[model samples]
Target chain A: MTSILASAEELTGGVCCGASVAVPREASGCAMEAVRALVRRRVRDLTLIAVPQAGFQADLLIGAGCVRQVEAAAVTLGEHGSAPRFRAAVSAGTVEIRDSTCPAIHAGLQAAEKGVPFMPMRGILGSDLALHRDDWHTIENPYGENDPILLLPAITPDVSLFHAPRADREGNVWVGVNRELLTMAHASRETLVTVEAISDESLTSDVRLAAGTIPSLYVSAIAEAPRGAAPVGLPGYYDEDTSHLRRYAELAQTEEGFDRYLAEQVIAAPAPA
Target chain B: MSEAYRPEELLMSVVAGLLEGARHVAVGAISPIPAGGALLARERAAGRMRVSILGSERHTFFTDGGRELFDCAAQGRIDAFFLDGAQIDGSANINLVGIGSYPRSRVRFAGSFGSAYLYFLVPRVILVAHEHSRRTLVDRVDFVSAPGTSPPGVYRPGGPVALVTDRCVFGFDRAAGRFSLSSAHPGQSVGAIRDKTGFEFTLDDAVATTAVPGAAALALLRGSVREALQEAYPEFAEHVLGQAA
Candidate 1:
């Protein structure tokens, strides 16, 4: 049965229709529509990997009980305020938190992309974050005496998920200046993307766009969801729905408020058929 | 008599002074004061200084997402940056992760972000915290997001240069691995700073009063920088600078 499923065309259809996956930042380019769909579908116990920082997406997932653990630099609502759901989860000891720094997460993902065991970074020597993370270890530089550095293990997520401006017919995505999305796709076992539009021409056809494009070989799935990163901005295309985000920030301050928000904004909305 | 300025505005002026010679300065998430300061510095430099503010399309130049900022810092492209913590000790160690033991226990902040890495990479790191009390300035940080100083053999180009608060300013001496009383803000005395600060530090003979932002600097802040800040930090611009988000 698995042998019959070996075609490239079938891969996108299979991968894009899944439940749990890693996602990009909620404040910026994320698969918000897919995240909404996942919430509506009642996906549970999913582990999400965020890009350095996240915002409403993390809060919403936590409020909906869709996440089991999260790995990221920070989960903040930015100018809006504290991420109410994340703060509540931490205080309640409900969710498993793997607190990480921005570069350490990025280094870890880069290591995974290169199939390296670990990547060494500078400046975390005295940080409590270094002390807490068992996977991160201190090692003396072979070249320099008495110099110690922090080495972080690779982070290969189960799925790389995001919202992009466009994907060509061949499935290659043009992410523009958001290149970390490329690294996420490269390091993850599977890539699921929601695009604002499907380009009529192949992304690789233009040499200029080709440099910014992620080849379909790394993308396991692609879904056409216009304004897929809504409420958060997509680079080069849209701005964050600031009022909506502020409203979420305000209403999500309490558990009841969060649940009410989830019920109305996410759960109550029907998944696209 | 000259018009008085807000405590935050005074702090921003001091921060701008610190950022004066920096060619490239980057401001991370939730840092409106530092962002404003950087913008002020840029304005002072007549747009000569490059300010890359995170979450702003107009300000930042990174095309490769968050990692690009870190990568650029590693290559010595960025000269200045800002970091704040839930707790900061005398040695300049920052704690952004939480209050208690890791994987469990107490309060948690929005994680470390890139402090650990950037603290080593960027040349000038200005530590900013609005509250100057014992809770914020601790004897020892529960967690170290980034150590102020590292061993000699380790390659480090960046660390805390100074700390600006509502009450005063403290200059970090890397050699002494301690903070020295630089100056106190208007209406704030050295004794008041001593009472507020949790960590012990060396004091100068006479603490100078923090320089107030002149009419020109104040004008630029309220006019251009405040308006520019609205793009990335709407609430901060509106609430802190009296501009609408």
Candidate 2:
């Protein structure tokens, strides 16, 4: 049965230590609240699979020492600059980095979504990204002679987490135009989402909203956390809190500063109502 | 000609010039200059060109998700794309995955985004690196996040066409696997660019000076283009273009 929780902390209970967690790319629609909850829980040895890319959320997890590994195309703060904690972690050899490209990450998830062992993809032929990843195999095309292609093994994450605009009581999430969230949900064993509000009416009742809705069947849990994707923004709902993010970028530069940020913003903060 | 322009505006003009004939152009994340250039090109093309700037609600048309961009590029729908690197070699090799050996590094950069895939699929890839020096333009990249050139039988239709930096523009020849000094930016000499660059490149005797944006171009940039760009890059529009978002 799908778990409908009232708080972000409760929604994060489904996540287990050492589990592989898949996250979306864009700064917007990221499960920042749930990430904080997870950080507070001190979930350890996590394998973070960024759908294609990552931003502040990945950095926070790495900073909190929750992630053991990161598999993504990139982890940056975007305009704010490089993700400080992520950079520090990589520099200190504290976290294992499994480098991947954008399309390859998507293809791997698509493979999982289709229940395939692997998916064939173009490019990455001459890249060191291909060279380093032993699991990514290169095989000659069976139909076309002498044509070699790279094959990525399915990336079936244990959990997929993100934020959205809203969800119905039935757990149907309205992710709108961020369709990669759908791919993440379909590919993972469990999809945990935090939304701005819990709609009493069914999202699928309307034809327009239904087109972008993720059916309740795919969602394992839902939490109502208003302004949940703060600092990152939630597309139409709000703009990015750049000042806050810029402050994070500066504070997260050092270990001591990061710890203080956790203490003030995360640990001491009141729990979601 | 008398009007002054910021360095970013100058770079934007150069990028716009490179994207002249492209039907569809995609700008990746955190690339305000390329985004500006694409917007400017779209304005000049009279809506014939499609500009997709990632992270913008107004600019992008992709509803199928992040993978759609890569899919579109592979199908040859995208004509031009922009890429940046922490280190770019003479051969056009780009390194986004930090300096030093693989897995471990002295200076770890933001890992390669989609360069490995898009660099091969997009026909015209413009390499943009604002910091043009020996440190950035290395003799050989420590890590080839996306190789500039591929061996035979490697199906590659797209690779770097040119590299634009603060100093000058270097036109890439895929057939020769080399870069030739195409043009020097205003007030920059060929000798000065050579001194700053670490990688080797052929310099033609008649290297032209990069044309600065004219009054009309500047007007469009500071007006409509800057306004359009604000949605995605408010800081860039405000500080770089000197406009309030």
Each model's TM-score, in the order given?
A: 0.91, 0.97
Per-residue C-alpha lDDT of model 2 across residues A1-273, encoded as one tens digit per residue: 678998999999879999999999764388899999999999999999998889999999999999999999999988789999998898789999999999999999999999999999888998899889999999998988878999999999999999999999999999887888989999999999999999799999999999899998999999999988876877788877888889999999999999999998888884432
Specify the highest-lDDT model's number: 2
Q: Candidate 1's residue-wise lDDT over B1-245, tens digit each?
A: 55667777888899999998889999987688899999999999986799999878888888777788998999999999999988999999888877887756477677888888899999899999888999999999887778988877778888889999888899999988999999988888878889999999988788898889988888888889899999888777878777421
lDDT of 1 by residue, A1-273 (tens): 111122222333343332345667754478777777766666678777778778888888888887878888888887778788887787677878787878878888899999999998877776667666777888888777888878899888877778888887788888887778889989888887878777679889889999989998898778777777777877668877878889889899888887787887776653322
Q: What are the per-residue Cα lDDT tens digits for candidate 2 across B134-245?
A: 9999899999999999988888999999999999999998989999999999899998999999999998677999988888888899999989988889888888886421
Give the worst 10-residue stretch by lDDT in candidate 2 chain A: A264-273
lDDT of every model, 2 decimals = 0.81, 0.91
Error of 2 at A36 (Å): 1.1
The parts of candidate 1 lying over 4 Å away from their true place are A1-20, A271-273, B234-245
